[model samples]
Target: MGVVTSIIHKKINEEENTILFFGRILEYKGIDYLIKAEPLISEKIPNIKIIIAGSGDFSKYESMINHKNHFEIINEYIPDEKVSELFQKSSVVVLPYIEASQTGIIPIAYAFKKPVVATDVGSLSEVIVDGVTGFIVPPRDSKLLADSLLNILLNKNLKNSMGSAAYEFMKENMSWKGIAQKTIGEYQKLLGNFEKPRYLIGSLQ
Candidate 1:
């Protein structure tokens, strides 16, 4: 997953207490957990604003979003070009996934140099370096998730530092060029001992 490298690192409408969930709305995506965690988060961080930006049937999650004043849902498809805008404006990106392989959102948030709060499921724990780049809480635990978000949102210095670290991690490890090179290296190692098929070469010639 590659980010728009052209989008320079500069603060764009950065709100210190804004948390975002940017992706498709689905049950497994754990938007419900995030919504459930909101009351707990708001109890601690009163000024917190949660922006749920994605396209889906948000009506299913209506009951969980008890704190409507603190939660704003843009229940429509976010255009590819406009994705960066949401990433840039928020203080932190949240992926409270109950089950996940990986998500493009994590790297995109890293590209924007925003800290993340994600659930400890699938590759999320591996991607987010807890207390370094972002926080990873136990899956389906709204309380723990809220605690993690509150921790980051409450501390400005920690939030900024984590965001910076996230950007560095993305540049060093998650860039598409690096991933491609690694894939190529693995292929080369695997194929180095194989003899070229003479018939295929002759056909090409």
Candidate 2:
């Protein structure tokens, strides 16, 4: 997937017009955090839009977000094909998850060469280098998230540099070809020696 995204991004050349958040709409995905951060971000960059791509019971969450200006909610499960469209349209991708393992979403963002702003929890920091690929704010810190988002939006050069670095990193390390080759090597090392089982499942005398 990462390999595919990298190739697609290289073919397109256009400026971004929005920011996108992709994932489940559960409480832990930190939609609430983003909602709170939006107002602060909008104050500085009014034209910047935050596009929420995923569905959940957003009634409570909606109230928290400042819907007065720059926000759009696509409260539905985004299909795989349309994900690229979302990525292409957005300036940056944010993964403000409270808890996570290795996220597939991060790779997708990298593949698209879109800079990310993620909370420093789980394996997110491992993937995103602060000030290189994107900024990693402490989890649950809406102020930091807002600040980081604002910084990336306001500075076009920083955004482009980070996006370029992310794309290069993904191409070299995170591709399916790279993963499969490494996995095969590991399996071969483990299965190098041949042995016959001495015991039988059933014996008859």
Top candidate when judged by lDDT against the true structure: 1
Query: Please, what are the lDDT tens digits per residue for candidate 2 over residues 1-205?
Result: 5445433533434445487898778888988898888888877876778888887777778668656467788888776666767787788999888887768787888888889999988888998989999989998989999999888889999999999999887776688777788898889987886444556434432
Worst 10 residues of 2 by lDDT: 5-14
How does each model score on lDDT?
0.86, 0.81
Provide TM-scores for the models: 0.84, 0.81
Worst 10 residues of 1 by lDDT: 1-10
Q: Which candidate has the highest TM-score of all?
A: 1
| Model 2: how far residue 62 lies from native, Å | 1.4
